[model samples]
Target: MDMDTFWNDFQLVRTGNPLVLNVTNHVVTNNTANALLAAGASPIMTFSSREVEDLMKISGALVINIGTLNTQDIGLMHAAWSSANAMRVPVVFDPVGAGASTLRTSSSQELLSLYRPDIIRGNASEIMTLAGEAGQAKGVDSSLGADAAVAAARALAQMHSCTTVVSGEVDIVTDGNHVYRVNGGHALMPRVTGLGCTATAICGAFLAVNRNRNEAAVDAMALMAIAGGMAGAMAQGPGSLQMHFYDMLYSLKKSDAERLFSVTRD
Candidate 1:
C-alpha cells in the first residue's frame, strides 16, 4: 500500500475511535491501552467470561495475548474467541514467547486450532514454533531474524487461514500468498517491554476499520515502525523512548506517515 492508503486507514482510527477488547497479559496491559489511546482507539480490557459476550457485541475487534497465560485465562480466551467469531468481529492473537516452554507452545497451538484468528503477530521464533519448526527463542526474544521465518510464517498463515506477522528489525506480514516487509523501527525498541504486545493491539485497531487483513497488518506494522523511529531520534534511552513513543503516536500526522512509511511486497 502507498502512503495515501496508509493515511486513510490511520484517519479511520481517529474518526471512528473503534472499541477494541483485549484479553491481554498483565505485563503489557497498560502499554497496550496507552498505545491504542494514542492512536485514537478506545481500549477495554476484560477477562470476565460473562462480560466478554456483551463486550464483544459492542467491540470492533478483539486481541488475545498469551504472554501470561493461566488455566482460567485460557478458558476465558476461548470464550472471547467464540464471542468474536459469533459477532464476526476481527481478532488479533499474539502468541508471545510461544517457543519458550511447553505450556506456551501448546496454548498457542490449541488456540490456533480452536479458532481462526484474523491476525497473528509474534517474533520469528514464536511464529516458527507455531509452524511446527525448530526455532531458537531466548525467552520472548527471537534468536532468528524475521527473514528466516518468512516460509514458516507463510505456512502458518495458510494452515490457520489468517494473516501472520513476524516482527524484528524488518517486520514481515503475510496472508498465505501475499507478503509485505516493513522497515523503519529503531534498535532501542526491543529494549522497552511490551512493544510487541502493543503492536498486536495496534493491529486490532487497524483491523477494526480495514476489511483486508493483509492491508490492516501492514498498516499497523508501518505505524509502529514509523512512530518508533521518530521517537528514537529524540529519546536518550529506552525509558525516554517509551515516553516519547506515546507522544509521537498521539501527535503523528499524515505528513509524518507519508514521509516515514516504507514497505515492500513479495
Candidate 2:
C-alpha cells in the first residue's frame, strides 16, 4: 500500500467530515460514534424507520450493525439499508456475533439476501459462518484465526460481489479477485469492547471518500492496525489503550503509517 495515497484519503475524511448514517445496535453505539468522530466522520445513529429515507439524503455512507438485534430494529435496519441503496450511498455491514445465535445468523443472512453491502467486516468465525463454513464462535469472538477464514472470505466476497474484511492479529481484506493482508494491531485491541465495531464504522468513513472500495477497506484496516500498534505501545492497559487509540486516530500521519504499515498483496 502507498503511504502517500493512504494519507491523502485520511485527510479527505478529516477535511470533508462525510456524514455517516448508522443503524447500529445499542451495545457499541457510543463507542462506534466516538471512533467515527476521532476518524473525522460525522455519525448519526438513528433506527427510526420513519426518518431513515430522509436521513439517507445527506449521508455519504451507511453502516448497519446487528449487535443487539430485535424484530422491530430489524425492520429499521432494512429500512435504513433500502434508503442507503436508493441514495447510492456506500453501505458497510457488521455482522456482529453472527454465528452465536440463530436470530443473529438468520438476520444477517436475511440482510445480505435483501441487498448487497459494499463491504462486510467481521471476525474470522463470523465471516466463516456467513460463508457457510463450519465455524465455531465463542459468542462474538472468533474461535479461529484470521488466516483460517481467507478462503471463506473470498467465497463470501464472490458470492455477494462485494468486499469482505476479516479482522484479527493479521487482518485480511479481499474482493474475491484480489487479497490484501494487513498486520500491525496489538493484542490489547481485543480487550476493549467495540473496537471491531469501530473498525467497521471507520471503513464506512473511508468508503465514503475513496471510489476504490477495495483499497478503501484496505486503508481502513491499515489505519486501525497502525493506530492500535501506536496506542498499545503507550498504553499500560485497555483503558489507556482506548484513550490513546482516539488520540492516534485524530493525530495519525504518514510518518506513523511509514513506521507501522505492514501490508502485502496476495
Candidate 3:
C-alpha cells in the first residue's frame, strides 16, 4: 500500500469517525488514550466483564493488549474476548512479550486460539514466539530480525486466519497472502517503553474507521514508521523523540506523512 492511501485513512478517521474500546494493559494507558484523541477518534478503556459484552456491541472496534496481564486481568480479557467474539466486533490483540515466559506465551496462544482478532500486531520476536519458535524473550523486546520472522508471521496468520503485523526497523504485515513491508522508523523507538504499544493503539484507531483489516494493518504500520522516522530525525535522543514524536503525530500533515512513507510489497 502507498503512503497516500495511509494518509487518507488517517483523515478518514477524523472525518468518518468510530469509537474504539480498549481492554488494554496499564503501562501505556495515557499514551494510548492521547494518541487516539490526537488521531481524532474516541478511546474508552475498560475491562469489566459485566460491561464488556454491552460495550462490545456498541463500539466500532475492540482492542485487547496483554501487556500487563495479571490473573484478574486475564479473566477480564477472556470475558472481553468472548463478548467481542459474540458481537463480531473487530478485535486487535497486541501480544506483548508473547515469548518471554511460559505464562506469557501460553496466555497469548490461548487468546489466539479462542478469540476472533481481526488484527494481531507485535514485533518479530513476539510473532516468532507465537509461531512456536524456541527462544526466550526478555520482556517485550525482540531478539529476531524482521525478515527472519516472515515465515513465522505467515504461518501464524494462517493459523489464526487474521492479519498479522510483525514490527521492526522495516516492519512486515500480511494476511497469509500479501506481504507489505513498511520501512520507516527510528532505532530510538525501541528505546521507548510504549512506542510499540503506542503503535498498537494507532492500529486500533485506524481500524476504528477502516473496513479492510489487512489494508488497515499495513497502513497503520506505514504511518507509524513514517511518523516515527520524521519525529526521530528531529529528536536529539529517545527523550527528545518522546516529545517530538507526539508533536510529529499531532502536527503530521497528510502530504508530509505521504512523503515520509516507504512501503513496498515483495
lDDT of each: 0.94, 0.92, 0.83
TM-score of 3: 0.95
RMSD (CA, angstroms), candidate 2: 0.8
Off by over 4 Å in 2: none
* Candidate 2 weakest ten by summed lDDT: 1-10
Deviation (Å) of 116 in candidate 1: 1.3
Q: For this target, which candidate reaches the highest lDDT against the unseen true structure?
A: 1
Question: Per-residue lDDT of 181-222 in model 3, one digit per residue for the tens?
Answer: 888899898898788888888787788778688888987787
Each candidate: how many clashes? 0, 0, 0
Candidate 3 all-Cα RMSD: 1.4
lDDT for model 3: 0.83
Over 1-266, each residue of candidate 2 has an lDDT whose tens digit, in order, gives 57777788999999999998998889889998988999899999996899988889999899999999889999999899988888788999999999999999999999999997999999999999999997879999988889999999999999999999999999999999888999999989999999999999999999999968888898899999998999999999999999999999999877778888888999
